[model samples]
Target: MPANTANVVAEYKDPADFYNLINSDEFSNDVGQMLKSFATARTVPGIYETDVSPKEVFTSPVSEIFRIKIHGDQAKETTARAEWENFTKTLNGKKVLSGVSINLEERLFLGIVGWESFEVSRLLNPFHWARKLKFTGSRKIP
Candidate 1:
């Protein structure tokens, strides 16, 4: 989201405008995470290939996903946090701990780091985490 872009999403409702937004590496990464998160939940490949526009966003809700235990002692906190949040919309401590299922069709959270990267494999079992998450609540770890 650009700082100067109109906050009124109704204004620039064109695919070209939305495509320009994809130029940001951050936005692309977020999309990638959303795809992966969708895969994790569905246990299948994703079907969609385009960005969801502001117009279509109101029609559906994204399924939530949680990946846990992803930081090492040497990692920077801000860097790690961005990777985590960028991968998914939900908060870090607010994990899907056994009931965050999606009957819909895809993912909303995504990542190349933090939870979905080397750090998480090093810290937790992917199978256990996947099976364990469902209906989750937030926790203040600090």
Candidate 2:
């Protein structure tokens, strides 16, 4: 480290935000138990809010699934059309249960993500672009 040396840069958008629900000791404990349960199932686990809604569940259909509750200025300009296009292109062969967008009431403009009906159990992973990522959630609508 020298004068005028280059350093890592991280621009904080919302530094004053913290969630008591997820930050408390009780939450940590509960999360630990949840992880244990998940592990027992021997399946992958998605990040928090990874898949907000399950796909193709007409029993109790949901329009959207959100990962992060907050977002920056760039994501605000997006629309459901963009999502629809992506699903039609990317997840074309897969079964799509529903696709809807909802407001997180946070900083971000786009926090909603949808789940493909055939990929409902795939919520444990969402970043897999090509092919399949073996992951799913344990919530069956029916």
Candidate 3:
């Protein structure tokens, strides 16, 4: 196995259980660990501020909007966006994520490094983190 590779096994009875697991602190910590293991360190440290809240527009299938402001390194924005795209692509390959989607919008401020910033907005599906599964005869399935 590769140095950055590991296996995780989770058993959930239903969608709600899967949702709860994703929203749990334990799952967040696991994701953090995976990020630290697989992600490369930036040569220059960047400052970033992020906000996430329920999206006000569409209530039928409740969603969240994620906004981030990044400063110091312009390349960081590109790198961050690429990482997000890769993550979503991976998610799309999973059968559990059928109707989920992520929309990204970006804006760049042209000026001095200290004065300039990169803004990114992501419209997140309500079930972004949840893993939906169907199980039968003790066999786990997605």
Candidate 4:
């Protein structure tokens, strides 16, 4: 079997907002910074800008999705929200998708870079200098 790559997600107040952010250079810059923050704060193997590429679709029957769960206190969540808002503040446009779900409980966040095959996924996500094991122990690929 081929190895699997992971993905990340974020919640938005409107679909238009999501699209606008995703399409902007500011989004790229902010996301690039966020990924670096994750690597530094979480001490996960750092991923570079060259290592990431956006995709239109992240889920499919054949896809192996990597799920990550963060257990933190409300203070941490509040901090995260502040950081996220700072990144998103660059979005100067209006909301496009109305009635978008903004509830914190209903949202998920995934960070992913699609790989052509499982082998590539495994190779890139090296842990202990071994390509056979998943790199980030916190993430589960099911």
* Cα-based lDDT at residue 109, candidate 1: 28
Query: Please, what is the TM-score per model?
Result: 0.20, 0.26, 0.23, 0.27
lDDT of 3 at 51: 22
Predicted candidate 2 versus true structure: per-residue lDDT over 1-142, tens digit per residue = 1233221112222222224444678757986566464343453222222122332222222223332222443442244334434644654344333222232433322223334442453553443421221112223221
TM-score of 1: 0.20
Candidate number achieving the greatest TM-score relative to the actual structure: 4
Report the CA-based lDDT of candidate 3 relative to the real structure. 0.30
Candidate 2 residue pairs in backbone clash: 46-124, 56-97, 63-100, 65-113, 71-108, 121-135, 121-136, 122-135, 122-136
- For residues 1-142, what per-residue lDDT tens digits would candidate 3 score against the true structure? 2333332324333446655665789877987566566456632211122221112122212112222333444574555454444545643332111111121123321111110111111232312322121111111111
TM-score ranking from best to worst?
4, 2, 3, 1
Estimate the lDDT of model 4.
0.35
Which of 1 and 3 is the better model by TM-score? Answer: 3
Lowest summed lDDT across 10 adjacent residues in model 1 is found at 133-142
Task: Name the top lDDT candidate.
Answer: 4
Q: Report how far off residue 91 is in candidate 2 (Å).
A: 14
